[model samples]
Target: MFRKNFIMSLMENILILFIIASVFYTSQSLQTQKTIYVPQGSITNIISQLHKKGYEVSPIDRYILSFLGQPQSGWVDIGAEKLNRVDFLYKLATAKAKMEEITLIPGETALLFFEDIASTLDLDASRLQHYYDQHADYPEAGIYADTYYVPFGINEEQLIAFLLKESTGQFQKISQKIYGTYDKKQWLRILTIASIIQKEAANTEEMPLVSSVIYNRIKKGMPLQMDGTLNYGKYSHIKVTPERIRNDKSRFNTYRYKGLPPSPIGAVSFDAIIAAIKPAQTDYLYFMKNRQGTHDFTKSYRTHRRNIQKAR
Candidate 1:
């Protein structure tokens, strides 16, 4: 009878100890991103990835997660930076990330791009610029000109960081594929040429021809008198006038400057970038817009004048 009483007392102690441990585990804190990319996998694999990513997850969390439900695939909204262990586990299983689309057209300036984003995403323009200034490696073209589905409700800093990070990765990959290396200074010069081609080329097919004209002019030490150079920043959609060209003193005023712009005129397309890298083989140094709205290429200044007169 005494032995039976002793066994009951030990069982009670064990139950109390288990309750204390469970309470402590549930109260543990987990730090998380506002949105996290959860891979498509079983609970064990998800937990493993979380652990690998420096989260305070363990094998035991897999058992807890199994009871909650299957974790969502793709991006999951955690909704908070810090949460108790139980809440974090529940969110991983149930919450879905909300996304919105943003597009930056080729030849658009970053100034207008951010304005569009501010209107579409309900974000502050100044804050976006502040974050961009803080994190971007370049003043512009830090983000690729393409459509992106970003998580909704992301703050300015996170948004800018995300775009820059993704674009830099893509830039590195493209550069590596082309030259087996990535050099920022050389790449910036290429972007300068590409941006001009993007603004001047009437169509994709005309990109290489425009690129050739730029190279020839640069080689001959002639000023690039292209009007497209005046379309930088807030002047993106504004028509360039002779008055504006004469008054503008920025380095982007290619007519006033003898070489390429100090930086890219605007965002560029893949075709323009390729054209900048590999220009067409041609001796033609002058081009004028003809009546057909396409440029007429010529080697003679006198013929170029005739083509300009015919265009008028």
Candidate 2:
């Protein structure tokens, strides 16, 4: 009877060793290293996935791995040739997703630009555009242009929040450097003036002078008469002819209307926004585009007319 008990104990020890070895082997070998998408669900979902992936895991082994971690929802690239049980569990528990980088260009309207951004992220462009139109209270004029990053699986609202937060941080830095004072009314006017400068100026050097023209007209109560201000809605710079100006009676018609436009035309560059805040100290009220792609600044309507004739 004692001998029978001894043999039974030895067999039980061997069985325990075999189970440990099998588990170790399972972890060291992943059928093939591939990307696995473990969505947010119960441990049962992960167990089913392991079976679907051609991993011959026993019920006990599945429980062991599942209980080790909660399922993280994302596309995780499992780069190892073979994953031991622990490694597989660790990778699934952590959502190590790839990031996508995108750039925002100055002067693009919010509708078009947001669509482009959504396309790059493989998201619904119309959804993103609608979100921007409905939620964002601020105009597009002062949005900072720069490259930004977004993680995989980020939702539309989350993406908008990230962009707004980053742009706010960028605007704050520039505000401190240039505006020096935080006044909402003043900033709105500055943004309006900056958008005009961004649209009208040929280069950085001309931005301040374009700003000067805007300020000078506003101060003297003279009609802005800027073609850029008329470049709005479905129509743009091409619609600023004498015929359109006479017939059109919109508030943006700077030739007929008085001061600045109701809102900015599009997003402005940092340089343009800064120039709007600090315009060139010039008495010139007129600017005509010269042959050299630069503008000829003049104080009198007579010189402005002569420049127009020369342009013709």
Give all candidates' CA lDDT scores.
0.88, 0.75
Leading candidate by TM-score? 2
Model 1 lDDT on a 0 to 1 scale? 0.88
Q: Model 2, 42-158: lDDT tens per residue?
A: 777766776777765556655666656675666666666567766766666664665678877666566667768777777887777666666554565545667777776678887
TM-score, one value per model: 0.72, 0.73
Please report, as a residue range, the 10-residue window in candidate 1 with the lowest summed lDDT.
136-145
Evaluated at residue 70, the lDDT of candidate 2 is: 71
Consecutive 10-residue window with the lowest summed lDDT within model 2: 230-239
Deviation from native of the Cα of residue 23 in model 2, angstroms: 10
